[model samples]
Target: MLTSKTRLLSLDAFRGFTIAAMFLVNNPGDWGSLYPQLEHAAWSGWTFTDCIFPFFLFIVGVSLHLSLHRKVLADHSETQLLLQLLKRALWIFLIGLALNLIPNFDFQSVRIPGVLQRIALCTALAAPLVVYSSWRGQLLVIMALLAIYSFIMLAVQVPDVEGNLVAAALEPGRDAGAYIDRSVFGNHLWKQSRTWDPEGLLSTLPAVCSVLFGVLTGHWLSAKRDIAEKTVWLFIAGLACLAIGQILASWLMPVNKSLWTPSFAVFMTGWALIVFACFYWLLDASPAIHLKNRMIYLMHPFIMYGMNALFLFTLSGLIAKMLGFIHLPQTDGSQPSLHALLYAPIKALPVSAVNASLLFALLFNLTMLIIAWGMWKKRWFVKV
Candidate 1:
């Protein structure tokens, strides 16, 4: 039923590699990164950096397909399954909250609506929808979500505008997310200024569409069909999405992850599909390549994501804070970073930009990997 062909090593390897890349881009030796890939595109576009989150989300859909495809056992009940789903959602949401609580438990000023929280809600929403809804129904829901978000973005106006509020005047689009979130969560949420967060209430609806696309793909893959046929269909579907997304970008919305526009969702979903195809062909069909071994050895995504996720992120935030405040003596005078402390000294020898980042990222990930490997070996997953 579920997890046929031993969990498709390619998928695992791809997942592991992506998670590692997330760490690399996130924690560079310097914020003044020489590599363009290390930085996220400022706004209104996509980049390899942008692909990281969607890739993880898309793979989440793929993993769902592989994990839950089995026919119900004789003793299993839909009621029981539904309970499991709710429990899973609550568990995931709480884990995200736990991550937020780390280092300091600052609820009053703490920002909510984090990455894990989004994944939790998106996954929970998508799974049940996939389970109960027809593909057409799911498609309609996705369209409805995108349409609603667009309307809100374009048509919604900020109330209480006045001459006194200089910041609001400077940026009128402030508090869009906060207005909605405050109405809903009632101040128990992220306060990222007068306007709402880019990863706010509205963006998530379309983000879930990415997961739905994955579920649809998973369902397609799970169908009783020939491998060649499945691969062909997947490729065609990917191409269709890619084409439609590009066409819709101009008329409907721009490809912006910060905004999480519908066009960006479609584009990311399309690329995810294409990536899945390549993995299926090279890794699944040709076992001689031994890609799974690489993933198992060097990656093991769940171990990385589940364990180092909170730990790595916390470490990263602290590193930034330390670098931001702590000044260091420099040849010229003084710099406001510990990054230059290590970086400048290393330059006393010889190092390229990539080499510096690679060395730093490697050390960073190795530290994470060691922690991850400890948990992996112990079979202890810090699930959120």
Candidate 2:
């Protein structure tokens, strides 16, 4: 088994992979021509794009456990740790809000619910549970949160657009969560659909469960046991979660990403566990030293990307915004966004529209990778 001092290269690599995937999905040249897997599911069910946020949240949980456990072992005061977490979460949330402000900077219609904002909220909320709760307690909290959220989502009556009380439903912007968001956030909701946000407040409860599941996995990894045993059990547990989540999808709420349904939370945790277990086995737990070295070398790029994931995530968003914000004069005297201008040549390439779009995303990822490599070489880690 690895010592506490031994850095988990597998975790870093997994995080890096997730960040890279996020860039790929977020920066497609043509949003209109994306492959199905690159886009989120329309409403219910899920696609590969659905897995990214849950994976990041799971990584956050694991990282939180490992880091906080270290501080506790060193006899750090609880108040100090709590303050640190809050400070970090606050900065992240503000950064997310700033990103939402963008070129327009319109606070009136700015989106309050966002990916990083959700991450920040989840981190802040899960902090106490991670700091004070036992593994069993954390598990119970996850169960309770899921059950309570499921109950509220299914049973709560909400007012519709007409201000009439309506029974609980899961139809697009008509759901209870959406109604709550509309009522609370008002003009501050997601602009595309002002009535609801995928990252709305009520749905955040289950998202915390996603992070706590990772925390539990972190506990398992930190326990004194054979690394191989840990890997095996993690995979087994993941399979169990997967089965249970699938059953819940049919019996309770369908696997919906927008809702952050209980089934989606559990099912994605299963995926996170299974995927991370494979990485752990191959990169950390494997008995074959030569093979492990080769694997590590191959995954070093991801490690670099993961090291400064938050910075890269924020930077990527800003750059993407700028790309669309700046306009270029066109031949007909009309203006096209820099994004459109840059994409025109690529779209004109003798390739399929989807392939061209995919190429642009890959190129954008390459730019990010180069920056990551530079920062890695300089040891310039940007901590939140």
Candidate 3:
């Protein structure tokens, strides 16, 4: 039921919205003290920052449903569907790798796992399952996958846990995930962790579950029901999912994204479903939504995603680095970084740190938006 124009446009807007948030939270003026909303929940809770990634994954599932359904309705050959899936997955995965090389290209130091790569793998795994099986089957698969991941992550002890099992036990409070990932990837792990990759192969199983939950929501949307009815069901479903996720998290697994716990998938998908219902009601069904149509301004988010997104994210980091490299001379001819210099006037006063960080993020995001606008003016959609 998605329109060629409207469907892609809505999806692009969703993608851009999430990516814009990514740039905002990531490039905050100071990480040490950020708005609690901007910081990812330390552990075992949700925050605004955590919503963005799951939202992206949910968007992926929404679009995938429309895409695969259209293929079926068109009577497309199975070969064609498979080919499209493979090509799209490869493209996303490769782009993630290519972006890892930006600001500096060092193969030895490059991260093996990243946002797009995780998306690519999750989509590849979820799509085939969604398209080939019934929605009930997909639901069962989601349950099984979550159960398996929970058991593997929380129950299975690392080989090296015992003193002579393989090596001395790690210090208390350490997770088994890091040890497992290190034993598997060793030196090929993420540079950030120096041992485990957050987007590692093992964690992606639950990532697939995230997509499966999205697919389940997609099925709910596709059901033969009026918009109001659909909205009501979606809200109910979201609440049910939240309850189930919390129950499972307490009993079987902890909701940790670094390990991609299945409970995290359920909880995030529940939130995404709730949001989709809100947007659908406001934008499509509400007669009083006078300015809702104006959201089309963000219709070309894919252009931002494919062309300027990585450029912009990397650029923000470079901007911070450049600020650090500044050597402004003080009255005593003492050198201070630009940020240090700027902080004197702002932080010296009693002001909310969040206000400053938000302003800086807004300015940078607007700059990225202008670049995206320029590309739009030229009809230049850079597809990956």
Candidate 4:
């Protein structure tokens, strides 16, 4: 069994893989020319891109359980632990807000809801439960949150754009969550759709449950069980969650990432658990020393990326913004953004627009990987 003191290589690699995927989807050379799977589902379904955020949140849950549980066992004060988590959450939220303010420090119309912001909120909300609740209590909280969110989304009526009362509406800007976002954030919603924000307030209720799911998984892993048994049961639990999610999708709420529907949270948690189980079994739980060593060697780059995920995430967003903000003079006397200039060569290649865009994203990930490698070499880990 893996003890609390044993660092899980699998967790780091899984986190690294998710971060790399985030860079790929977020930094595509041409957002308009993306593979369907690379793009978020326009409405009430999911894509590979949609899985990344939930995966990261789930990892946060697992990490929270492992870390906080250890501290609690060590007789640390729960209040102090909570204070530290909230402080970290504040830093993360501020950084996310800072990213939105970049290139145009306009406080008037800047977005307040973002991926990092949502992560911060979820972490803060779940911190107390992880520190103070038992496994059963955490599970009950997850159920309660999901049920409450579903009820609000389905049973609550809200005013639509046309000033008509609509109930059970899941369309853009018409749902209860969207109404709450617009009412609360006003001009501070997502720029793409000012009527609604995907990472808005009410949706965060269910999002916190996503983290709780991961915490439960961590509880199971840290239990005094046989390694093989833990691996088998983890996979089974994931399957159970997947089944439940599908049932909910058909019977109640459809799986919508933007709304962060209960089905979506459960479904994505299932995927995260399954994926993490594979990693845990291969890297930490499995007794195959030679194969485990080989896998670790192969995944060194990801390990580096995972070591400084927050720093890399922030730095990458900053660089991407700069790439779009800075301009270069073109031959036709028209100035193009640095992003356009950099993508020009790849665009000229004899390839489909989608393929070219994918290539650029790959190159961007490689650049980040190189930076991660350097940071890893220098032992520079930026902790919040």
| TM-score per model over all chains | 0.79, 0.98, 0.82, 0.98
> How well does model 2 score by local distance difference test?
0.93
- What lDDT tens digits, residue by residue, belong to model 4 across residues 342-369? 9999999999999999999999999999
lDDT per residue (tens digit) for residues 34-56 in model 1? 47766677766778888888877
Put down candidate 2 lDDT per residue, 1-384, tens digits, no spaces: 234476899999999999999999999999899999999999889999999999999999999898887887778988888888989999999999999999899988999989999999999999998888899999999989999998888888888777767766888788889888987999898888788899999999999999999999989999989888999999999999999999999999999999999999999999999999988998999999999999999999899998999999999999999999999887899999999988889999999999999999999999999999999999999997
If ranked by TM-score, best first, what sequence of candidates would result?
4, 2, 3, 1
Candidate 2 is scored at a TM of 0.98
Lowest lDDT block of 10, candidate 2? 1-10
Ten-residue region with minimum lDDT total, candidate 3? 164-173
Model with the higher TM-score, candidate 1 or 4: 4
Spell out the clash pairs found in candidate 2: none
Better of 1 and 2 by lDDT: 2
lDDT of 3 by residue, 251-301 (tens): 766666676677788887888778777666655544555555654333445
Error of 2 at 34 (Å): 1.2
| Lowest lDDT 10-residue stretch of candidate 4 | 1-10
The CA lDDT of each predicted structure is 0.67, 0.93, 0.69, 0.93
- Candidate 1, residue 175: Cα displacement in angstroms equals 8.2
